[model samples]
Target chain A: MTAHATPDDVKKLAALARLTVSEEELPAFVAEFEAILGYVGQLETLDIAAGSDILPYANTFRTEGTPHEKGVWTPDIVKAFPNREGDALSVKQIIAND
Target chain B: MESNLASLTITEAARKLRAKECTVRELWGACHAAAKTDAVHAYLEVFDADDAAIDAAQARIDAEGENASVLCGIPLAIKDNILIKGKVASAASEMLEHYEATYDATAIKKLRNAGALFLGRTNMDEFALGGSTENSAFGPTTNPHDTDRVAGGTSGGSAAAVAAHTAIASLGSDTGGSVRNPASYCGVVGFKPTYGSISRSGLIAAASSFDQIGPITKTVADAKALFDVLRGTDVLDSSTAPEGSYPEFTHEVKTIGVPRSLLEQGLDPYVVQAFNTALEATGCKIVDIEIPSNKPALAAYYIINFAEVSTNLSRLDGIRYGHAARGETLLDDYLLSRTEGFGKETKRRILLGTFVLSAGYIDAYYRKAVAARSALIREFDEAFKTVDVIATPTMPTPAFKIGEKSDPLSLYLEDVFTVTANLTGMPAISVPMGTVDREGTKLPIGIQFTAPRGADERVFTIAAAVTGEQLY
Candidate 1:
């Protein structure tokens, strides 16, 4: 129930989130992060009653009937892509070779 | 027509338009003049081609005489987060500062059909991350009532614009009290309909479950009119349900419940007094209600908010149409771009979200928060059965001065009274109770009323009663 975030944990989280946290900002992040976690730790003491529905609803995304055909992606929608090749977004290789 | 057109509510403006007391051009001129008259810093950008847009709307009104929508030729400010076709939808972040919306949001599309005129895009907290517009990357929006203080945010600009009479009414997205917080601070009516009441098709998502687009207006009737146009299902957003998807508010609001536990702690005395006066004016019997979930509500709200924001923002890598930073590799590109593009508060949220959702901490934080959220929803549902509505001070206190709450936790506490509605997916509104003097300047405070899910009408009606306005 003692929730605390360490500087290493902060660094790891930032890395996972694809954010570059400078060394100068790391200590501040650690301090604030620990404070927030401690605040949220109060929830650990909550005794959730049995059979209390946790999820708001199941299959909220599913429709009752047949779905309509989606609109075709147009060239205009691709305007945000930094690099494009023949209507496809260009990306660096996901599978790297040695 | 004797009164200033700029100060007229949406209902009054529409009536005047229909009565030929003022032409659409004249109304536009009045609102435009008022917008230029103030230096609230409410707008990030006012469209340069306002005259052209006004002419187009006026032409439609002229051609469709007797058939025009109430919003026809009525100018409105839009929060920078909601998309207007071909307009820059920044979400007040550097990431999308130059990005143009590919298509209109479903709400915008509906409003367009209704012939609403766009005044401009107003500023907001970067990615709608903070409680005050102070976090806006562009700059903070100042409260019109007191120029030195903040307009409550992330809908600060929208609220300020309405309060200043810059726009007849405006739209803002509320994720954990964005709209209502500012509305209370700015002394205007702010409303969030039942979650999924309006489609989120074009809104830049902050926290998906809690995010809802709502209106900021001078009166409840104006909020209702705008809400009417904005609500409906959208094929693009599965979360939105069709009109009448939930049962309507059929019975009159007769009994109001005040959470006794919440009011006993840390509430400003003047705010409490104003709230009591508003409750007494309602003429409904006030009953003490206990919401056990209220204690843990803020903590749970932030946990879930962080988790969802982290996930939602993961889509903003350098490759897509926002601000892009160059790096040698794709990973480096994402890291550098986000680090540069996001503001301090945005980064803080993303990191917090990532930590909560991370493998080791997921169950300890994210899952428990969801369970706590569900408990809060159940508590709200139980309260609604016994009481027609729940009322509280919209914010613990009125608007704070700029830079007053620099620390994060102090700022998070501002949403104490408003987060429950968002968590429960219920309709809630903040109507001006009256003003509480802060150092000789009278700052407006609002009394918030929360109704059961889909009981949007009930909230509006109760608000009307509290404000001494006739129900629309």
Candidate 2:
């Protein structure tokens, strides 16, 4: 497939990434990403093995029990946020609920 | 009389310290002075000679003597992402600028126990996200060889610190090509050990599966020395294999691997010339290389990296322990804190990661990336069956201007030659082959070597033989 990724496409990717992109920077990002993506597009033609040999489940242990992935965080630890002054984090509102 | 301790390698300094040729305080002051004058280093902070602190650290080691790790009393630099109690571990991101660490990273604890003084934190890409130090919120680090070009980064400050003699050696986390890339640009040796070879207890998350603390130093011997101390499992980092000592790590080899396919990529002519010269000079046989879907490794890497980062960084909402989340609702704080605290590139990654991992797109993008990654690794396994190691240009080109490409993808491509090793969980290093760009302003090009999963020792030994020196 001889397909080219457009600036709008790249911008959409950037926005999904949550990066703050000025309108002025869009053309530059598009051109540059297009160059790289175009080059990398060659990957579409190659054949790759289908499955992984890696073990996805890592070893984990807890004081109370042994688990596959240890040290999972709990919401109680989530209470440790410094920015949270009350039940929620406090900051200048980014948008108004019109 | 050479008063600059910065000009000396830790190996040399350790010998001097052992011989009583230089006192710890004297060495510390020399290091302190060196750190201050080396402007290109871009160290996030520097410590005053803590005579008492140095004395205290050295006293225990002195009391322990020969049993102590060799890095004792040596002052060193730490990349910002590694934790050091009371100091901030910012990764040069503004969000964590005010955040202080509550404990030492496991490796830092070991180094401290060995009597190494902390010189302060070095600069890096925001959250270790970009290639050039230009992505640093603090500012880009300049290559000491020629300030005009970049000191290839996210670990630029660490490499620059070693190059400018700001620290005898420095600690950096390599995810993709951070350590080796900068080390090559600065004419130093960068070693990224076998995955899980070293602990990552306190490294701020940057593609967790791939990140590992590596060393950057003037010589391979110095890097080897630091590596000796830094290697081994930490209970704190469960990913590591049980602690095992290296007895035959430095044994030399007569055969080296050179991938014609990898080397023939569109490299700068000078880099191409230098790479071939170094390989030919080694007087060793070159073995062929292979990896399936080899071309896809770079693209797969970025996709996987973005997916991992977005998931990992979702925790940094202004509410919890990072920059405050300031939105009326929980989601608002998460969005604003992430948008504000993260640099442009970091945010771009998080969004891409988030999108790729999102429900509708997960299988098409994220899962596809992982599948491609497995294919690449299998290819590496197959190639190792025929060769002891694989060699390629550490980077596609020499150091580019700091901001020549605003496109994030171009920056990601900088890791192309280096990322495959990261993906396969293999050990690799970059040694300065020679200069490529014009002199005075000449930029250093690097040649990389990779060995099998458990064969990090072989890679180092082979690198030592080919380079014909300690890679200073």
Candidate 3:
């Protein structure tokens, strides 16, 4: 599609990213990012194989497990943080006190 | 002569240090003093442990002489996302506020070994998720040019620090235009090498595939100087492109291409005039061309980026290393920890990324974005086929007000010109073009130069060419 990624797209993207998109934010995202997508989309049909004969992107990242080793928690690394309160780090309560 | 090292590049700094013009300690101290006065919050922590870093650098310079490293004794600010051994890398988030880095990032090791003095860690958007450093849990970094405005972030603090002369070069990670956007805003040189060109180990990555750590400096030459110290394969980032054999930068400037589609955009009128003026001054042929698949660039960026962010951030379970909460059950602990450690923006992105990467909806968002990303790269390859390099306004508009953009998506538009290269994994840079009216104030605008695959050095060459039009 010649059309750019729009706010409806951003909202869908937000939903895909698991973010809660507010109603107030919808219009601005549409206006601002649609223009941005238009700028970026300008490259849609540049023929890359013709010259320098190179592929534009590289897919060589070493995918290692941030190694989510499922196991019980050890205190040594956790101790590095300054405040830990009863099996949890002591921090101010988030959200609101309503 | 007493060393006038503050304004010196890493190259000059090394020469002066070797000539014994001044000791590394003196240089380090001076950088610290200058950085201390910057109220922009460029630095998260300025190490007084300066003596050790200095002594280590001096020992190397004393042994290896000028060969000590490409960055010997040059003071640098690291964006908070990268790890520094024994130092806290907050990534400008409250979660890791008190958490100290367990190891040094591979790039940090390379530069440190080369004798670059660590100035301190700079502020960034919390978890490297936002466009504006405004999302930082700590505070927003004011533009060095105009304090009332933003620094063009997640790397805004790093860019501002370099522009303000607080540090000569700063390391910033560019994922979806974090580095180049801020570089353009702060009127400094921000270069993002091709994806996988620079090592990513030790960086608290926001999106794994797109993140690249590059230099944010005052000039293209400085960026090149730092790049030599930074670009290399590393064991930590086992995923680095197999030592992509690329040539050094060329001094000559010739045929450059500009996409008509990109040129005709929502850019401020003054910026448009300035971009054309800079191109005219380049004395190089301004061959107008078409690069299709460019417009969907930003939407594709948010998609692929947030999709990756969803999967990548899943590691921050508040269990292993990040923020953890105390609760009777594990579920409660996970919920409490995330809510406490993450800022509003980080949480928002995490949610967004997670949703996009989810099972049923994957094809609708993530797949389409990835396909679009490939299409964009193909488009860039095609353009580079015809032209040596591509040029565009680094940003459509100059740096906006601190709170002007309330919706996160609107702020993402600031990356309009820079994200195409990021999406395609092509090398791109933001060089100072000229000033534009920034809400009634004069602000710097950047002209972006992008080169073909493995043409990182070429991007620098073209930037140098553009910069020569009105070299400072």
Between candidates 2 and 3, the one scoring higher on TM-score is 2
Worst 10-residue stretch by lDDT in candidate 1 chain B? B242-251
DockQ measured for candidate 1:
0.58
Name the candidate that leads on lDDT.
1
Q: If candidate 3 were superposed on the true structure by all CA atoms, what would the RMSD be?
A: 6.4
Each model's DockQ? 0.58, 0.29, 0.14
lDDT of 1 at B350: 95
Error of 1 at B144 (Å): 0.7
TM-score of candidate 3 relative to the true fold:
0.84
Q: How well does candidate 1 match the true structure in TM-score terms?
A: 0.95
lDDT of 3 by residue, B1-472 (tens): 2224555666667778888888888888777887888878787778774677778888888888856765777889899989888788888988788777777888888877776778888988988887779988888999988898889888988998888888868999998788988988889889999777788989887888778888998777788888877787765666566764555545455878988777676778888899888888878887988866677767778777766776777666566566666666555666666667777767666655655566755655566667777767777767766688888888888888889998666777767777887777778899999887755677998988888657787788778877773222
Candidate 1 lDDT over residue span B19-72, tens digit each: 778888888877877777658999998875456667877787778866787788
Greater-DockQ candidate between 1 and 3: 1
Tell me which residue pairs clash in candidate 2: A16-B351, A17-B351, A17-B352, A91-B326, B220-B470, B318-B324, B318-B325
Cα deviation in Å at residue B46, candidate 1? 0.4
Regions of candidate 3 where Cα sits further than 4 Å from its true position: A1-98, B1-4, B62-64, B244-252, B438-440, B469-472
Candidate 2, residues B1-472, lDDT tens digits: the string is: 2357667888788877777777677778888878887679569888666677788756755576666567888889899999987787888988888777777888898898778888879988888888878888888898888787788888999998998887889998899999999988888889998888788898898898888899998777777888888887667777775544323344445566665666566767788888778888777777665554667788788878888888777667665576875556655655577778887777667756765676765655566667788887777777766676788888888788767866676677678789988888888988878887665577778889888766777767767765676542
Candidate 3 docking quality: incorrect, acceptable, medium or high: incorrect
